[model samples]
Target: MTDITRKQFIKLTGAAGLALAGGVGAPALADTFLHKMVRKPIPSSGELLPVVGFGTSRVFDVGRSAEERAPLLDTLKILYDAGGSLIDTAPMYGPAEAVVGDLVARLNSRNKSFIATKVLQNGKQAGIDQMNASFHKLKTSHVDLMQVHNLVDWQTQLGTLREMKQDKKIRYLGITHYTDNGTRELVEIMKQEQLDFVQCQYAMNARLAEEELLPLARERGIAILCNRPFGRGALFNKVKGRELPVWAADLGIHSWAQYFLKYLLGHPAVTAVIPGTGRPDHARDNVMAGMSPLPDEAARKMMLDHLHGL
Candidate 1:
């Protein structure tokens, strides 16, 4: 096992006083996240993207303080070096958009990011203005994807996004739904709209998306972006004392993060999962899940069983 030191990891990641001292070359294993998943087409432009992404929610809300953001800065660089680039954020996530913008701008890796953010607006101009703020903060000419935050005021935001999409200011458009109520409503809108993506919650414990939401997304061909894949740290808490199962070796899961991530990733309808991270070690563990052996139908069922047994 690689004992990655705090200082050394930071150095390797180019964050302030630390570096990537060891574990730079992680071993290959089965059941790793990237075993067989391929990019799916956007339908509108036939663009293909990897099935894993990073969420910048509470972790990326470090505001303008460099000290509060130093670790996050390193995490971003680590993500880029590790070949993981999809970053999801929003104006609601405090200073998340700004922090991501500042850090990536410094690294000039903004181009490498699959930038996605949200705007919560009750009015048309408020939506437009907030999105413009997002663009300026993210330091990008156009965001890769933009969603109406939490599907709130979709009546105005959805119409506004469709217009913006036609203007080419954003590459993709959709709405987000985080609550149970929002899920039902958003699913119906997705069935009726010509959207390219949808952001929502999905995790082991919260299997609400599995019932009808994810299935419908699969049938409709709308790319589903999973938010709170870590369930806001609830999954980690649940597995606190549990060691990585021995069978995890057969599946190539060396960490609990991989265990949870692989289960969510095993879903065929899932386009990408965005797990938030503030520490580099946790970030690496999360990215490594993208390289796991994908569970087939039977294996997926087994995974569910294993998770419940936890």
Candidate 2:
């Protein structure tokens, strides 16, 4: 195929299949676009969820000050309208739960979204209280998935999360660790116990997650939630002047963002990749990455080589 121009690139999206648009009175299915990676089955339950996810880490978690969160409302709407369902947030992110709570309530999209959050507390009672706060803040009856954030007080909190899952207040229970050190321990925790989802940073630039965490998740049938898909803007900067490889068309990757996102979502264990953003265009581009052909082995290797060279 010939090289796709920047303008044409902007118009043609990836072919991996994604549910990019939604219509009222008819909720979109997981397989709406056929451009994103195929939906993965939840380990504990059979419900299939899209492998692309949304995060509330940076500017998005700020609803405390009116000026700080004015744009996030629009961003969330874009996400919902585009068939995005998985929303990952935590008390670790300042005011994110609060912002999400208000917006979800106002939008009345609480049931439409799959809520995933964390417990950042010590001991069983404290963990329960924090979860209650999360529910109250998010204005939801229960969370879709609850995780122990970075193993903080894991011993004390994990048991409580397990109990909540038993009671059905939460659908899934899991643990998270961001660093490589955390990976081994998280893997051990998965080995010892049953978990539904795990959240961590992953990108073409950060292959550390691939080294062991992802493999373990795949082994346990645990869903992996990937954060920092853009490498916190570093990857974007690296590709600023670079053009998409001509062969990208074979995999349906049209832009640098889509190239990077598709590469991560292509991984087998990745249940979802949560890239943070507050802009409508960025949200659309990121969500659009969810739709189409995740490159096969050969294309992925070439993508890494080209990105490294760029």
Candidate 3:
């Protein structure tokens, strides 16, 4: 399939009244189209973040060899070109942090990217040391956001994070957990500390966060970064052979990825949904969900019903 430029995409979809040919293989759309993409503000600082961002977990843990790094370069370019910037990574993810740093440096997109990494050490000094290492690996002195991964020694780590934020080593500080089991503890932490962000699992299959974590984040003015948005590819498996509902096209959803992402974006409290992908085509498909006309309450319910039936 031939990749389409932003102008070609707009002309094809707008003037020619055509849909995306295959939902992938297209490069990022143009800058003029970026303004039309959905953006939600960080409650504490009112800085707007694109509703769709990148994630580096299992997919980004690869060797520094060109064979391993080539596709990743394309993926990051597709993401940045499409107006997506926020990237979530952690020291626990092995070489993922180094890969992101190297790739971003190669692309010279450090100024354009919103880099987020985490610290999971047990002691305050250890936490500080881990974050310092993150800065070095990320090839930047100042990071956009730093999170306490899974609340590991959260109290000790948060103190370090707070100090870093004050010193301008990191712009924001928050906590993260990938399971519904951690929501209660996250809520308690939110009530006690002033946080700029909270990342938790919130997807079609995982609705537990919606019951409490999401509402309280809004109440406390904390930005939400949703992880496991695709249930680690379980949602795709569930609909492997099925076709999209006829009404999905009305919202400009061309693929199942957009279908799932749009459902999460439908909730008002969701700030951004980070779906990890190493494939550039998948990256292109993922960013398209950040556009406007996302699913509404009624549409979301319909989607839920459809998924349940599937």
Candidate 4:
């Protein structure tokens, strides 16, 4: 779609060559679309993941009624239908983990979903018990990515997770934190631990990770997942009622959501940005940010300067 050769496109998306040229796990609806999401390699194993993913934090804790779930169903449909994966959820996000499990089961998309959930309890056995509940709730035998949420008893949790990985109960394990103050601890853990991923808060407005976490993640070969890419919606408030910058077309951005998300995707260390949403339209817009022609350094600087102006 961006005039890229098929080989280049494969390279960009980390697609598995011509075998998946048609896209291996792509939803049927995606066959008609030419543009697929760009994928970044996981620094640990070199496996690729689309750079835009869905986050379920307070957004997916919905009622059981079909009326309430109709929109969320459409949201997941739009994501996988656009060749996107990587759904980040945590047991702490109320019903989000269960909701995701239920919705994905209803859609019969368990294999299609990249399930990443967290264990938040403070002790090793408590963490194991919680993770067991997550598996039962998510209805999965092997989780794709499991995390130690907010680093709560992270050392113990990591040890247990390593055992799970050894037992094939989980494929990969990582660490996450939602605040800036936690970076020092996170950095220390990253330095000493063999983690597969690191989830941290980062966005145009929240660049605390850029000072150390991001670079350190790259140095350590740990994949980075950015949360709060919208600065917890403060970014939207900043651009409220303003027209999208015309030059955004140069970077393939069509909406402020894409603009904000593209800024995160442009960072070298980011494997994906999991923006939580229950709306189909919002999910669709978020996925577009992972397509080709992301902003370069100069354009990212320009975009940041514009945000500073606000």
Q: Report the number of the highest-TM-score candidate.
A: 3
Q: Tell me the lDDT of model 3 at 49.
A: 93
Candidate 2 C-alpha error for residue 273, in Å: 0.5
**Number of clashes recorded per candidate:** 19, 23, 0, 0
lDDT of 4 by residue, 1-310 (tens): 1233222333443422112222323334455246878999998889889898999887798889999899899889878876787899999999998899999999899988889999999888899999999999999998999999999988899999999999999989999998888766788899899999999999898898998899999999999999988887677667654666778777877667778899989888889999987866466667778889777789999889987886
What are the candidates' C-alpha RMSDs? Answer: 6.3, 6.3, 6.0, 9.0
lDDT per model vs. reference: 0.74, 0.74, 0.83, 0.82
Residue-by-residue lDDT tens digits, candidate 1, 1-310: 2344433433433421111111224432222223333344565566777666778878787767778878887777666665667889999988889888888898889777889999898999989999999999988889999998887798888898888888988989988977777778888898888788988788888889888988988788888888777665666566654565677767756666677777887888887788877776566666666664666678778878877887
Runs of candidate 3 exceeding 4 Å displacement:
1-36
- Top candidate on lDDT is 3
Which run of 10 residues does model 4 get worst, by summed lDDT?
Answer: 15-24
| Cα-lDDT of candidate 4 | 0.82
> Could you estimate the TM-score for every candidate?
0.85, 0.85, 0.90, 0.88
How close to the true structure is residue 43 of candidate 3, measured as C-alpha lDDT?
Answer: 95
Candidate 2 regions off by >4 Å? 1-38, 64-70
After superposition, candidate 1 runs with Cα above 4 Å error: 1-40
Superposed model 4: Cα runs more than 4 Å off: 1-33
